[model samples]
Target: GTYRAFVDQLPRLDALGVTAIELLPVHQTDPQEGSYWGYMPLCFGAVHAQYAAGDDPAAELAALVAAAHELDIEVWLDVVVNHTTEVDAAGPTYHLRGLDDAMYRRRGDGSYIETTGCGNDVDADHPAAQDLVVWSLDRLADLGVDGFRFDLAAVLSRSPSMMSRLEAWARTRDVRTIAEAWDAAGGYQVGRTWPGTGWMQWNDRFRNDVRSFLRADDGSAALMEQRVQGSPDLFDAPGDSINYLSCHDGFTLYDVFAYDAKHNGANGHGNRDGADDNRSWNCGWEGDDGAPDTVLALRRRQLRNAWCLLAMSHGVPMVAAGDEHGRTQGGNNNAYNQDNATSWIDYARRDEFADLEHFVTGLLALRARHAVLTQPEWWGDALTFLDRRGVDGSTAGPSIGWSVGDLCVLANAWWHPTEFALPPGSWTMAVDTNQADLLDPPTPVDASAYVVGPRSAVILTR
Candidate 1:
């Protein structure tokens, strides 16, 4: 899709109540390489010509940013500064490889060190490479880009000075920076180990634990509680964690409930490309095609429960595009090569899954109504984690309850219903994932206890 076409969709995103939109790599890539994901950067300073409808790609990108800002949405661009399309010695020579071989990391024999799984790794430790990255970011900031999400940021973190230099540059422009915090290789740095200070890290721990709890895995309730408390076990502040259920790389939220295993045969990799452990439950039947109505209803309830958990969590929530409307890729998790219907956001699903879309919108609105969900600091003494009986302790069962200020959230991951004892004041129900519609009319609850549905969540406010 062209930048103008993307501009037309900003209003729909605004209606979803998102404060920011992060686009995949917009940097120029080699047209001959046939890369659909744009992870292989050909030039850091140029915009991909295919994404622009007008003659000037830079101008069109600026226009896109302007349109998003008009809708009160901040635009964040994903940047790939780790590797390029120039693979190895036999690969095509781009500007950097042709000009200076020192741009890449090399061994004693002068062969490339492939830490990125892309055949070669950029030597971000080099001063010239650091200068090039800052220069490119400055050019992007000049065009009104609000922030950047670094792909494979662990590669850059390998250098002692690269992150510090980038931070110094970002401070002058007042732009935000986010880190993926891991590389294709085993360079894992998720929390304070990541070099960038004051930068948000994608909390994959939150994603995995939430998915495990949704599928009713053993010992997931304690992990889910840690994630719901903004992952105090991982990060220093709530804003340091960017919580998400799915992203461009993983299964869509709908597919998480519809498919047990990846159907990536279309990627031409023999269905062996995507991650093997997806932590997904098929809800008694795989693939939604001839599933019974009872299974379908359960799937919808599962989706709502996932969204409710994400929205109620005390970190910055991120929703993948097309996830709000039940978009499916035929169970293709690694769709990096298929640019056809498999990757495209089918707008028709908006009408097909209108109820889900409405539910997502309502959940976001409910999140906005509560500041405790997105606040920067920790919950500290104000929040109390409890069991279903309202006793304070580590939640070890399938049922968990928590009270923070005026709000109480109860979640039951069992196959049968569970009753949760309430705290002091009279409570009214604001959300229940079992119901198709949100609480259009708030329902008051009993003074002492409330029964939560099986494999669902409920929220009460006094």
Candidate 2:
């Protein structure tokens, strides 16, 4: 019934101009663990029975997929293959653990080898685990789902050859493959970590780099440059890096600026459940309830800045489901346990921050309309950054150059205003985060240089 509720909103998602819908794990969960988020899967062959509007879970899920396809909206499942709800030896033996403990990872002493930080990790290195995962993919593919984003995908990397074979299976069937690409323990494959054949990974590099750069951390300019250029060091290909600023695991884009520290006490884990280094700046206050208007406006602009940077980056950009409309998780970074309004997108905020929605719309429209932004590879020397000074150009400057069709985006993270040198041309301002809406019109800046506002971003189209 809950998933059928999502089917009713396919048009809403399509209207946002996003291409794919990433659903959290939908597989059945054992009741003993109370896995609200569905990451703790009980069986790979079935959809969770509770989510079905009808008696047949498979049929209900298939109808949802069919509805999404009618709207040309690709549905992607965030499936977990790393571990199960049958957590540890003491946990439960309802499914996988009961079927065969050897099917799951274990040390020689018969203790669980916990790579997932979820106590029990599925033994993906074995052929049986590979067959189960492949079978699940085929089942969903036959049901008409478009793609899958693997949770704790780095576990697949443990058996890289098996990972490649599974990826190959998806490709043969024409299903798009993506991965979380890391485990909680030690797998940080932000870019090109696994062979990743026929696959893309969630770009943690893009997320952290953009946050730190926007907050004006030390040496952030170069970091910003690398990300804007698509992080070629870690990724050998373009779309291989899923450029993003926020996701389900951390603060929403709005909350990233609305809260300086995580307030995850409601998670009942002593406020230590979520990330400690959020790289967030709350403008002036710790929470959103009572911030000054100036602070609020700055926060809004910063949200737009993050959005614009994501749009401008070379990789395939991924925005959290509600980030475009300024969704706040009430400072609950680890809201995996939150199933109420705290986790749901507040429709009221969508209109309250309608300016943000408009800006994001224009940004996505702009990205879709530009070839440089949508290129399958970095523009290389074609795109160049110009270090800026004050309006009079007195401060130190970095090399400023650009190709004829490239988009030159300037970001002023300094506390004060910074000036930039734009090559004299028929350049139109494609984006300015400082504007009321991101794109009011194509303002012609026929000057050789211009001053950028403090803590703001500008995009120039030549």
Top candidate on TM-score is 1
lDDT of 1 by residue, 1-462 (tens): 998899888988889888999999999999888658889899997899999898999899999999999999999999999988898888999788998889999999999988887888889999889888999988999999999999999999988789889888889899999999999889889977887787999999999999999998988887987899899998989999999999997799999999899999988879989888888888999998899999989989999999988988998898789999998888888898888999888999899889998988888888888888878789999888754632333333477788887789989887777778778788888889888768977789866877787888998877
Model 1 lowest lDDT segment of ten: 387-396
lDDT of 2 by residue, 328-437 (tens): 98898889878788888788887888888877877888788778766786677677566467665566332122332546777776667777877656777877778867
TM-score of each: 0.97, 0.95
lDDT accuracy of residue 446 in candidate 1? 69
> After best superposition, candidate 1 residue 158: deviation in angstroms?
1.0
Candidate 2 accuracy as lDDT = 0.80
Each model's total of backbone clashes: 0, 2
Top candidate (lDDT): 1
lDDT of 1: 0.88
The residue pairs found clashing in candidate 2 are 1-51, 389-419
Give the distance in Å from residue 275's predicted Cα in candidate 1 to where it truly belongs: 0.9
Distance from true location, Cα of 300 in model 1, Å: 0.9
